[model samples]
Target: MRYRFESELRRWEARLRDDWYFVDLPPEASAEIHEWADALPRAGFGAVKVVARVGGTSWSTSIFPSASGVYSLVVGARVRRAEGVEPGEVITAEVELV
Candidate 1:
């Protein structure tokens, strides 16, 4: 299944900047995350990570999902540049476990 959500990149980054970034995901989004984690195992998910661009500096979260069935979201690398979001502000992401 595909999952999509919109959040401020700066806000998200701010949360992640610390060890415990509370996302406070909604019910639908949380369900999607669980589903994606379940599906990742079958999709050959060998790695999981977050790709964020901040102030022209590209950085990614620590790799996750070295195994399957452990995804967190549906943000991927194909997302286009959106308005109001700087290159580094990670908003409306498309992450895949693999």
Candidate 2:
């Protein structure tokens, strides 16, 4: 399955050391992901494997379940730099389930 949407790039940190950015998938996409995950073998953390595209850059990653009760895609520093994306800026993402 393929899903596409626009979302705000949100910043977060882990253990106050690693800074990360992610975009939350819309509720409709999350619902589809739930069904997709159910029919596939689970990965760690319920991550759904995908190939994500942002701007002109595309990379392999996974959509992770978020505390917000949805799925979110991590936009790595390399990807952010390649795409010239900034936190709080809206970005359109294309995710292909793998």
Candidate 3:
């Protein structure tokens, strides 16, 4: 189904995309994403995007739902704005990886 993201999610997604970072959620992230997307009751539904900022350096992560359980924090997006090796810069969070 064609699930349109809510304004909140859309805003975050735009930022993430602009930053050149696709969601890097966990391997099971897809499972949760699929559940939510499936709930959309449509086809071609994109994954669930959240509005979170980068917290750690080594690994960017976020929590999402899954048919198997409640929450799962998987590999999240990368910081497109970050340059060199000087740690990633956190933005005012627009969208997040699902």
Whole-model lDDT values for every prediction: 0.38, 0.89, 0.34
Compose the digit string of candidate 2's lDDT tens values, residues 1-98: 89999999988765457788899999999987887797764569989889999988999888898877789999999999998889999999999888
Which regions of candidate 2 fall more than 4 Å away from where they truly are? 13-15
Q: Which residue ranges in model 3 land beyond 4 Å of their true spot? A: 1-19, 40-45, 56-98
Error of 2 at 92 (Å): 0.4
Better of 1 and 2 by lDDT: 2
lDDT (C-alpha) at residue 58 in model 1: 42
lDDT by residue (1-98, candidate 3, tens digit) is: 11112111112243554522322233344454556654542322232444344333333333444354433332233443242222132222322433
Error of 2 at 25 (Å): 0.4
TM-score, candidate number 2: 0.91
True lDDT of residue 96, candidate 2: 89
Off by more than 4 A, model 1: 11-26, 42-90, 96-98
For model 2, name the residue pairs that clash. none
lDDT of 2 at 9: 97
Of the candidates shown, which would achieve the greatest lDDT relative to the real structure? 2
**Tens digits of per-residue lDDT for model 1 on 4-95?**
44543322253465432211223564455555554444433443344543234343442233123333332233322323344334455433
